[model samples]
Target: MNSGLSKRKAFLQSQKNQGHRITFGFAGIADFRSFIGQEYIAGMLKAASDYDLNFINFAGAIKYSFFDDIDFIARYFKTFRFMKKPLIDGLVTWTSSFCELTDVKRVEDTFNSIKPLPMVDIGYLDLPGIPSVRIDNEYSISILMKHLVIDHKYRKFAFIGSETSSPHLERLKCYGQELQKYGIQELENSVFLLKEMNSADIAAAVNKMLSCHDIRDKKEIHCIVTPSDLIASSVIEELDKHGISVPKDVAVTGFNNQYSGVFARSPVTTMNLEYFKRGYAAVELLIDRIMAPKEHFDTLLVPTSLLIRQSCGCFEQSILEAAEAISNSEEPAFSLSTKEDFRPFILEKLRQIFPNLNKNKLLTLADSIFDDIQGQKKESEILRYFQSLLQDLRKEGLFVNSEVQQKLTLLRKTILSFLPDPQKNQMENIFHQLRILASVFIEYDTIAPREDSYLMNTLSQIAINFASAKSGRQIQDVLRYQLGEMGIPGIILSLSENMTSDLGSTSLELILPEPPADIQKKLPFKITDPAFIPKFFFPQGRRYSFMVEILHHEDKYFGFTFLEIGNPNISIYDTVRTLLSNALNTVYLREGRSKKRTMLLTGEELKGILNLSEDDSSEVHNGLKASEITGYLLEHLSEMTDLDKMARELSVSKSHLVRRAKELTGYTIQTMHEKLKIEQAKKLLQVESLKLGEIASRLGFQNQNYFSSVFKKNTGMSPRAWAKRYLH
Candidate 1:
């Protein structure tokens, strides 16, 4: 048997002893780094890895340019389904994002293979009776419709959407349904659906709607609703080229609001689908499925948000009034309103803008805004009231999220609407200040992802370096370069030597800012608790934080990684920590494997061992010939006693085989046969249970005495006596 086979057997044997373990498989149509997989899979896996769990990620290959997109996808799924096994506790899949109804059968087939086990589907489409975590897109679309009808008061609207997928079309269908809800049914002139998602196709749809007589001439088409912010952006841009200004000429709304919506010329009104929460929920539901398998599968529709921006005619009258009121530069002309008057108005607008806000929080914010305005405070103080209110809403916990940046933009504008009117220059001045605050909010949103991008790129490079690493130093270089370039400069990496329950006097494996030549000992921290409590050491005067995470490979701990933390770039920190543990384990295990390997040599004491050297011990120069010939002989020894037959088995000529055999060992085929038989007999000689006649028959000797004579020639001892010498 081969060493690779032996290693595989050992691995399988060890797996049998690993008590109960949970391993998850994340499968998606797109590759891990692609748009879809990053949102739905990697984030949860990164979080899960810190705990005692195993994650196996399956995604399409990046560099298979030889195959077309269709071909590659088919092959990707073909391999992805077969990769499933009993070991994978659950699967988190996104099938219909990149694939649609056409591939549903294969997706169903794949899911069925993992049936009876938990499967959490976060796809656009899911199989019947499987727990599906999907965005409640209907509610998101309904918010846009309600905003258009009640707030902007635009009943007639054009819908521009593409059949990108059925779910995407379902969102578009909501537009007509929403318009009809307002008693407007003749939507033929205002609806344009595109076959392709390309800009040319979208532009054609816009032109087709403009060409319609009902829509062409100032018909009450208040806004154009699009299925995606990307399409909304294109529609707005195309409409711009035709001299139609958003909110000035018409309003526009988009779904799945993205950066395109936030930064469009007249920032678009869109939806926030809560990207991370969806992934986290998927895993949570899958875990629940395991813990309680009898629970009915549910289609969990998460909360959604409608972000009102300038494009959808949000805060239109407020802006004009604010500008007019500020130009006068005097305080006057306030609403003769009591707390009751202001309270309902403020709460209603806030509830519309931030639908997700708790009622208590909304009441608190409304009271603050009301108190400031009723007091007739100075404009700056008044602006701070609103500013502080916006600031309070942005506290990290109230779902201040990736998409909430747009809500902040819209919310500040909504605040301007409730300001005391005709307080000349006061409203406009406050609005301008609000713009500045919004810019700061925007800047905060912008800087975070830039840091994330830098971290992702750097971490990707570090991963590449770690994969090709030949030694532990190369692994350390990855961290050194990462810390020096992107991470904090002042840091120490104290790598633990042992992974036992106790770290056993942790030594600093690599420390930055090398000590002077005279200092022989760069000290290691004595952290008694293996949990790595942060209080152990602090660099004096620097407010550096630390996290001690156990470095593990599967279930085995390799070491603990101590990180100097400050304003975390989360993805980078997680990647480096995970790669560090994996790298150290790789280095440690490779060296251990090399140390543990025993030398297999030809000897009477171990003649039957696989890889036992079948060569003259003294002849080192002819190693390759003996090694190659021994391999062929090991498998075919029972069949190759004759020169012709041996040559035929080896695919060599009889003359060539005999000549090589003699040149290497000074033996004919017949003599070599006797020698091989005697060697085999000696190997079995230690087994006293085999009678001498039985051993002779097994070795193909004529009789027991003949087998003994051949064995004696090889080992200078008779078979029974040889067996007695070892077995006794």
Candidate 2:
């Protein structure tokens, strides 16, 4: 063995003996600007940071609907293969997002492959061993339904969503249960199960629902309840085209208080999932599970709240609602909320405002001011007293302009109620002068920074750099230069041997912080080796963290890249992976002549999505190149059979190869291999000349009966019937 290899092994073993810090892996298809990605990732990262924990965020854009091409799915999802034990102590994944890649069971089976490694789902995937921290969808939907039915008094209603979503189904069930409580049956046209939840499909569903009744008719649907805010916004626009206005003509409500709903034309009435808290809770749960391996953990249902807005026909703003908004203030001072049966609401708000100040002192201040006003103290004396209070607040460093204004307003209102009609105008004059005096002491910022514009410009430059690179070396050069600019200290580039799915060995093409001369020669090593990356890559006796992402395009499986998680902005990590993936695919096409090159979307497509001005960008639609690459992957994989044989031919361990297969197709290597065989079997069965026995033997099936049984299990039909139906 090479000396570099021996040292690398030794370094890793030594670190292991010392019992290094626990590392958690967070995997997500991070479209960072999107609702779930932004909120959940932010909360998770915040918790990890606060606890001083090490986390590896395996991020990529691997949505199946983003590309029509089959190969892209295979390449995009290979990022998940890096979620192995020893590298990471526990896995925290957004499994609901995985439903965008393939079936739920496939995702389940793939995660199940990594058993005994404590895993927590951040999204709604309810597998047996893995506990999920998800929004209480049933409770959220019930709250929404009650608002629509009882508050808005909507008798006739409709529910719409993509047929494939598990959450959507759960919502539909809740919608049904809610309707049943009111003694109303779900009418035939009242439900819209769309083929997909994009704008076109949702709009078409809306049109179908509206076909039976004119806008003026009494039978028109009162409200359209959607599973997402994005869909509800689309439905609102579609209604407008036909001369129907939201709330005025028909009320509309949506779930998930995303920007799409918050910034909608009418500002959609929806549910706040509080995903940030859920994300924090998920990390806490995973850590507990990791610490106590034998302890049983149950699913955590994070409570969601209703966000009432104009679209729901509830224009009257409740005092409690207004207070809640103030409680979630973005100001540096404490939030304001009231206790149900404690002191006065205003007193509670005051207590939170000045926590350091004694409660008795606050009450005494209020009592003294009120007592003087009631005693008919001179107006000038009262004015002087108020000014002194403002000065004291400033001295105490409690002069948040808004909170100060709240205190002044509360005092002014109370004083006015105590004074006579003539004295009220004098009191207002005194308060007006105090406001002017307060402004003199406080410096208020009038202009907010244009961070959005600056971010867009920076991303544009980075995207152009990646897009222009034409070769593997050029791509690596771009990565080397841009790493520092993206706030990343260094990166480790690894490539699968021969750019194939074979995981036996990987070439460590580049490490940003070059190793010392003795260990530098071991450029690539077999994955089965003790250490995939040398211990010298990390700082000695210091806290360290790193992230890994897959590098591939279409059906061409390259490898994965490892880097220190130096950048706190999760979006930057995702964006970098995208640029790296696209650039690598371009290089692969240039070098390999036998393979057909698949075109990837330009950086402009990314710019389009990031363009916050484009409201319609929130809606998924056809012709959108939000995907990575295009071509066939399964069409190629279908030719292979026998997981053990495939592993042997590739000269890799079966378990390692199986993980690659699972990451690619969300199935075990053997299961996916069988699925591939069945796909081939279907084609052969379509041919009239081929006998069932001949087709079975040709596709590597054990026997005719076994092939038939497998075929039936997969396709829900026997081979004879399937052939009879399709045969010409």
Candidate 3:
């Protein structure tokens, strides 16, 4: 076996013996800066952290012009070659991201090359054997259709979305199924599936929908359903321009409760396809596969919720009304009309909102509320208990004022109904007091959004800082300066000259706030850990949640950046990633120029040592002629470390080449190679300004220490001492 492969196996074995976490690889063809990308990555990180395992995300995009070049795409895709056994134990592929650029068969083929590692597909495409974790588009569409048809009494409906998206197509099929179920025949012209989603295409679709007035019904379409919220909002705007009022002239609904749906002018009625649940379910499925390789698993279906709002021709459910419904369910657990049965009902309702809330704590809370309702607890004591519970939930980042008010209101209304007729008036006054207290608590305790101008200014400053970075160190400085404002707790930066070609030599460049001293010593470390993070780097108590994102510009694979994401606004992370990649590329180019100059000078100096003229440049030779062995030795210093390979390349016996090189250069072949490397190092130190570690790397030394030892052995001084004396 090759030395590098042997070393990697040994390293992995050692890590395994130390009982390291099982590492899972997540591959996605999406830029992390996008809304979908950010949510998926964040969800995966959260889920993995909960399991106390490891997740390494390998992400890139092929949709944009910058990533259009074939060579660049090839190189970027090559980064996935590292997602194999001994590096990651299981895999999750975001297949949906492949819909536009490629198909499922191609994606399966790409991953099949690295098999025996269990895999999970997180997308719409159903790979034959690989279990998929995706949102139930059919169920979500059915819910929306039922609400629109049965509740709103909308008879005719039109559909709008892109043809490229799998989920959209699935939703379209379900929409047709629902129409048939309701006995409302859809017109052929009503289904407008575009090649792509753009303003012009959507405008054209809207025009076509309006012009088609069915003579059978003699009525315009009652509603339009779309696969995406953005498209739905655009349709609403276009319809309005033609004097059609939403839910009046023509109602509209959208899929995915994205910001465009929630904050759209008309507030689109849509389905909330919770991406976090998608991410969490994906990891669970992947882990199950890893643990039971021979067992078959079904495709995991993540649930979605239908959100009612104005665009659907209906008013949104108010907090009070929602509370009333929860308190009046016919189901046994939710028949919360008496104190004797309220505990289970309250706990169940809260559990739906906070799934991870402690069961014992929830029971205690239920009892406390019951005590207050029975008049066994003082008013001040009841208020204190509510305040404490709310405060704890707030710190956990789980408190939402509207949701909290809804739950509290449900509790209040249920207790008033259970009281005797004579006590009803007295109990209603107590409930009124509780309502006032909740309002005051919510007003004072709600987390406020950060100032818009401050965020904008901070982002602007971050961009400027990145633009000004001229070196890797300067880029690190920029991160240190801006991580706090950006809400990133820590960062680990690794860099490679060419990640696909030289992954084994990729350097762990920096770790923020510094890891422990032992971990710090592992800098300039290769990716020997299966997790792609050094073991023990994250303490068990810390619960560090992070995602690994590629650092590259198109085909130029620089390295990976592992970011700790705590901020809800993910746009900033994408901005930082873009600027950082550009900055690193700029530094890479700068270093390339310096290396060219240094290599040129070293080549000339090597010829002088061999007593050869410039016209006899070693690069000009095709083969290692007997007399030109010294030239060959100097030309191929880096590859000469593998003697057997070198001999095969030269079409000569190893012993003969070694004897010939010694005869020509008056030193052994290996010794001559070392001498030449030292000569190049001396010139680089004297003529150029570079770090010792960089000089070592440029000369192909294993590390700075080995380079120093070789230099000292041949030069009678350390490299630093020689540089200090000669440069001056």
User: Which number leads on TM-score?
Assistant: 3
Better of 1 and 3 by lDDT: 3
For 1-728, candidate 1 gives per-residue lDDT tens digits of 66633543354335434543455556665432223445555455544443334454454333212223343444344333223333356767776654542455656655554455578888776676577888887787888788888876676777877765576788877766776778877556676777888899989988887777333233667778888888898888998888878877878888775666766788888887776678767766666566566879668888987766688877534455444544544433336468787778778877987687789878876776665555455545545654665566566534344344355445545555445555423544554675656555755654554334335666667777777776777877776766655565534565544443222224455655454443315345433222222222324322233333445444444445545433334334444556776777777777662222111123332334323445555433423364445544543333335556556545577777777766665666567667666666665554433478865765557777877777787788887888888777
TM-score of each: 0.49, 0.56, 0.58
User: lDDT for every model?
Assistant: 0.59, 0.64, 0.68
Model 3 Cα lDDT, one tens digit per residue, 1-728: 76633543454446456776667878877643345665777688877776666666676643332224455335545556457655578888876676556655556556654556798987776666789887888899999999988998888778889997767888898888888888998876889988778889999988887677532232667788998998999888887787766766777899887666755667799998888788877887787777668999998888899989888878656544744664684533223356567777667765765566688877776677667656665564446666787777778877776777676666555545545555556555665566556555554442122112125678778878898988788999998878888887778777764423222234577888678788778676654222334445554434454555666565455667777656754444545666787788788887772222212224456656765445543433344553455544544443326577557546678887777666445677677778787886776675333578866765668889989999999999999999899877
Q: Which residue window of length 10 is worst by lDDT in model 1?
A: 593-602
Better of 1 and 2 by TM-score: 2
* CA deviation > 4 Å runs, candidate 2: 1-18, 63-70, 148-156, 180-189, 204-222, 315-481, 495-504, 507-536, 539-545, 553-559, 566-571, 574-728
Candidate 1 vs candidate 2, lDDT winner: 2
Higher-TM-score candidate of 2 and 3: 3
TM-score of 2: 0.56
